[model samples]
Each structure stands twice: as C-alpha cells, then as structure tokens.
Target chain A: MIMGNLGFLLYGNLVLIVILYLYLYKIRKIIGFQLGMNISMLVGGFGAIATGVLLIYQFPLKFVIVTMITAVIGMLIGAIFGALFDYQTLLTGYINGLMMGMMAPMVGAAANNSVLFLLFIEVVFLFSLVLVFLSAKNT
Target chain B: MNISQFLFVLFCLNGVIGLLFYVVMYKKRKLFTDRFGMVMAMVGSGILSFNLAMMLFFMFPFNLGTLAIISTMVGGGIGILYGALTRFQSLLAGFSQGSLGAIMGTMFGAVVENPALCGLPAAYFIDVEQHMMLFSLFGTGLVISTFGLLFYSLRV
Candidate 1:
C-alpha cells in the first residue's frame, strides 16, 4: 500500500515538474528577473524537498545516496529555471536549491512512518506550484 | 587529523572567512546599492551560518535542542552583522534566511550523527564519523567558493 502511494506521488511530482518546465519555457520571455528569481527558488526548493522526502521514504536504507541525488536534483532544477532569465537569478536559485536539498532528506527522515505528513507535503507542494503559476500569469 | 580536529579546523576556518567577507563588505558597503547589499547579506549570512551550525552540531551531538538554539542565534547574529550595512529590508531578509539555514544545518547534522533519530536502521553507524568529515569538508569548499563569487561580484 505504501509503495503504491509512493509510486503515485513520485510520478505525479515528475509530471508536475515537467509541466512547470514547459510553462516556464513558454513564458520565460515575458517574466522579469525578480520574478525569475522567485520562480526558480520556489521550484528548486520545493521540488528538492518533495523528491528527497519521497525517495527517502521509498528507500530507507540508502540514506547517503538519496541525499546526494536529491541535492543534485534540486541544484539542476534551480539552475535550469534560473538560466531562463539572469545570471544573478541563476546564482540565487542555485544556492537556495542546494541549501534546501541538503536539508530535505533529514526532514523526510524525521517524519518517518508518517504517510499523512508526506501527503501534507504533497498538498503544500501542489499549492505552491499553483501559486507560482498564478503569479506568473498575473505578471 | 581525526574527525573532531578536522571539524574544529573547518569551523574556525568558516568563521574566519565569514569575518573576512564581512570586513570586506563593510569597507565597501557604500559601493553597494540596496538590492545588492540585501542579496549579499542574505547569501553570505545564510551560507556562513549553515556551515557553522552543521560543524558545531557535529562537534557536540548530545544536546540537540541546545545546539539548534545556539546555531540559530549564531546565524541570526551573522545576518544582523551583514544586514546592518544596508536598509531594514536587507536586515529582515538576512535574519530570516540565516535562522532558517542554521535550523536546517543543525537538523542535518543531528540526522547524520544518529540515523536512528530519524528512524533509519543503524547499519551505517560505523561510517557516521566519515560522513561527518566528508560533509564538513564539502561545506568548507562551498563556503570558500561562495565567498569567492561574492568577491568577484564586487569586482564586477
């Protein structure tokens, strides 16, 4: 049962990230540097946290590997998103993502055995994604 | 040197770097506009405090709550120091980011030290010391590179 839920969450997160990427690509030209910085930071930080938590939950034993993977994932996501706008934004996003990624696994591990907390994180992640989309659309 | 000594050296080194950066920024605080100053404060304090907190936690792993508080305070103090050169807005940003980074760093250190605290199996207990050393080294490198970037930004 847990495995099924984890699978669903992981795939869903991937889809959302891809969708976000496409959306950002579509609107990259329209967004300013400030918005770009915020967008990149949001995506990188939350994406890292989600990925770290979900993966850690799936594989409890490979803690070190999971941490490294999540950190890389977060850094990549942030850099990619930030690259759309300005160099400084790229730097900001990269550092923010790195920090969040480094911290995410421990958070996930701390909430061990609590599927509900995972679900809560997922909800919050989705909500933030929606907020980002709305904010981008407004600008 | 052993893990503890290595961590101690790293900790002192991080602090010195932070101080150097602070002094450099202070000397040229007039050159930075509001936005640049805010960014510098936020990034500098956050990263510095994060590395410091992590090393401190690794050094003293017994008192989790106390360490967390100490790291948080240290982070906030660093933030204030950096942000003081700028406006109130920068101060706010630095303080919050610094505290957040410190909290996260302490948590990471705690989890690495005692995987059991996070409900993980203690299979890697023997490797915990190595992990601590590796992470501290990585953090030191991160601080150095970031300060270098900040200094470069000053040049540009």
Candidate 2:
C-alpha cells in the first residue's frame, strides 16, 4: 500500500489544518473583519481536516491535494463576503466549499491537461486574492 | 456532460452569483439575511422533492427505489400532519422521527426486494448481481433525502 510521496499525508493532514487556520487568521486580519469571518474560517478549517483524514486513509493523494486547495480558496472567498456582509460568512463559505469541492474535480478532469489544470487553479487563486485585497483596501 | 457534472456546474454558478448579489444588495437593503433560513429551507425542500420524484419514477431497475420513495412520502406526510396539529416542539420531534423512519425503511428495502410487487417493466429489471449495488445507491439517496428534510424542517 506504498503510495509514494503520499506517506507525508498521514500526518501532514494535521499540519495542513494548522497551516490553513493560520492562513484564515491572516486573511481575516487583512480584510479588517471579525465574528462572521472567524466562524467561516473555522468551518472551512474543519472541513479541510475532515477531507484530509478521509483522503489519507481511503482516497488518493491527488484528491487530497485538490480538496484542500479548493476548501482554502472557498474560505478566502467567504472572508470577502464576510467583510461586506456581517453575519452570513459561515454559510457563504459552506456553500462555496460545497460547490467548489463538487465542481473542481470535474473542471480539472474535463480540461484534461495538467498544465491547463494548474493554470485554472492559479487563476482562481489569483482572482480570490485580488478580491480579498480589494475588500481589505476598502475596509 | 453527465447530469451530475451539469448540476455541479449550475450549482457553482449559482453560488458565485448569489454571493455577489448578496454583497451588492446588502449595501442597499439587508432584507435577504432576515429570511436566509427560510430561503435555505425552500431550496433544500425543492432539491429533495426533485430527487425523490426522480428516484421514484426512474429507479425501476430495482425495487429499492420504490420502497425509499414510499418511506419518504409516508414519513413526510405524517410529519406535516403532526406538525400542523401539535406544538412547534412536537412538530420538530415528529419531523425528526419521520426522517429517521425514511432512513430505516430504505435500509430494510435494500435487503429485501419484492420485484413481483414492484411493478417494473421486464426491460428495466436489474440483474440479480447488480441488485445489491443499486440498492446501496438507493439507500444512500434515501439517507441524503432524510437528512435534507431534517435540516429544512429545523430551519422552519
């Protein structure tokens, strides 16, 4: 059952959760937000942890990576909404995570090229980051 | 694209648009958040209704689909009736019980199939070997529908 390079995933998932939480905190501060954003980050963090645990044991490394990335991006988008809307951030993140988790794999598979997939992921990341920065500046 | 992929795409677009709309509208009017729970309930119920209806009519390869639908309908009807007659707490309790019943009934259905009584066309009948697999899928749908109802009811 040696699935090369995935060996780190067994324990790396725990570390990943910690890193994700820190990132959430940093992004929340940058956006000058509180309460709702915190809750959203917590939800997203827990979701990533759950996915990580499941992937480590039952699924492939690729799924683990994709899900973790998608969940983090979802939280960032949620934070942007949290800045604009005071109380709906947690629910927003949940919805985003649900949609992203379900759709990202399909988009990746449909594109059918590693380069294209990476390009798409990077673009989404950049877009979310830009939104976050704009919201932060407005605040 | 497959139905699921199509649905996922639609869901993603909805999420993005909904988020943007909420942000834009919040500046002008905060009405949306006030009814968020109800809105979520409506969406959840609508999706469950569609899924349950689909399962009932299309899942003719095995008898489990019919059983799941029956269980869900019976449970939901009893829940709504009890809710209408009793206190809110009683309504909630009854709804939860009904959802649980739907799940338990679906499990039972998966294990036992009365194909003779199922009334499916011969062409749609599942092979003996695939029965268990399809039953599991039907059972999963039942579980999702049950939880979804429970969530929607609680929101109400």
Candidate 3:
C-alpha cells in the first residue's frame, strides 16, 4: 500500500533535507558564500536524497558506485582536508556522512552479512578518529 | 541468530573489547586508561561500529530494517550541519553529536524510524530477530561523542 519502509526512508530523507537547508541559512554568512549553495548542507542534503532516490528508483545501477564514491570524497576527505586548511570546516561529519551513504554499496559487494560489514567500518572510523586526533595534536 | 542478531552481538562485543582495550591496554598508560581518552576511544569505535551496522544493512537489505540504518546515518550526517553551523560550538561539539546521535539512535530502535534520517542506516542497527537495539544506540552514542572528543583533543 504505502510501500512501508520506502515510505519511511523517503520521509526521513525529507526531514534531513530540511535540516540541511536550515543550516545553509544559519551559516550562509560563513562558508556558504564561498563554497556556493550547492556544496553547503542544504543543497547537499537535497543532492544526496535526489541521487539516493535515483539509486533506488531508476536503478541506473552503475552510477550507484560513482555516487557512492563521490559522496565519500565530498563529505569525508574533502570535508576534513578542507577543515585542516579552512578555519571553518565540516569535514568530520562529511566523512562520516559519506560512510553512511556508501558503506552499503561498498561492502554490499563483498559479504552477505550486515553485521560483519558494520564491524569492519567501525574499526576504520575509530582508527581514523584516533589518527586525526594524533596528527592534529602532533602538528 | 539472524543478521540483526549478529550485529547486536558485534556491537556489544566491540564495545566491551574497546573498553577493555582502554583498561587492559592502557592500564599503564595515561591516555588509554584516562577517563577522557577512554571515552574518546570508545566513542571513536562506536561511530564506526554503527556505520558498520549501517553497512551491514546495505548488504543484507532486510526489508524495513535496512532502511532504518539509512535513517540513522543520514540523521547523523544532517546533525553535522549543526556542528558545522555552530563551528563546532565548543569542546563539547563531538560529545554533543554523540548525545544527539543516541537520541536519533532511538528512532532506529523504533520501527517507523526511517533509515535515511536516523543519521545513518537501519541495517547498521536492525535486530529484527532478537529485537536488540541497545547495542546499536550505544554504538551511535559513542560515535558522536567520540567525534566531539577527538575534535577537541585536536591540536588545532
């Protein structure tokens, strides 16, 4: 009927879109002006939802990998690298967000078990966090 | 058990081991065994752990459960907007995210929870069989908090 889980997933994305947009307004003075509206959270939220939906509905399939990788680069590496350089940085969350967006597809190819995939990523997250902390302090 | 059950076990085991690593591994060290350091390490591992759970869902795609993991990750991502907007507020930014993530984590604990919005994925925390969500929540909670602590501990 309502598509149960799909309905809920779509709804959640919508809410995230709103939060991200509101952030755009909140930080428009700071980072948005420089990065443009699209790179900012509001637009990124829409982008992720739109692209994610496409991944779900159209099933172009191939783009799933590209989109997944791009999201990772954008929200994680770019965000963090951007932070280390820029005083105003959203890299940490970006990295984590990318992980959220891509983990499924990345590990989906390998193991059939969700639990194993989660454990693998957690190790990376914690290790990275530690590295970043150590590096930042030493620097 | 099922995939979700496996995930539940994974979270608890990881959390226990992480803490143990803090205690046993750092019993002689100041950083590892220290309250703050231990918290940060635990939280760091927790964030990934939940992400791990989310990844699990992407692989398994267990009906509503998979979507739930998405919600958690997305929610966590969106919350980043908060941290970013506040410019990370204070030393508590990472910790705040962890706390907020836990709150959002509960939504994953609940069904209509929306995988895309809980800040991550439902597969990450879905325990359809044994019905265990505590481990999932704890993992997410530690994640946000760890990020905050890690950020604070940063030299920058």
lDDT of 1 by residue, B53-105 (tens): 98999888569889988989999999998999979999998999899989988
Q: Is 1 or 2 the stronger prediction by DockQ?
A: 1
How far off is residue B36 in model 2, in Å? Answer: 2.6
**Which candidate would rank higher by TM-score, 1 or 2?**
1
Candidate 1 vs candidate 3: the lDDT winner is 1
Best by DockQ: 1
Residue range with the least summed lDDT across 10 consecutive positions in model 2 chain B? B38-47
Model 1: pairs clashing at backbone N, Cα or C within 3 Å: none
Give the TM-score, chain B only, in order for the candidates.
0.95, 0.31, 0.33
In terms of docking quality, model 1 is: acceptable
Q: Residues A1-139, candidate 1: write the lDDT tens digits.
A: 7656787878889899889889888988999988988999999999999999998888888888888788778878887888888767776877798898887888888887588888888898999899999999999
Q: What is the interface RMSD of each candidate, in Å?
A: 1.9, 13.7, 11.5
Give a tens-digit lDDT track for model 2, residues B1-156. 444444344334433433443344334333233334322322232223323323333334546556666757755654544333324543454465445545544543332243333222243245533443343344334335334433433333
Per-residue CA lDDT of candidate 3, range A34-69, in tens? 343124322333233333432333222332334344
Which prediction has the highest TM-score against the true structure?
1
DockQ of each: 0.49, 0.01, 0.05
Give the TM-score ranking, best first: 1, 2, 3
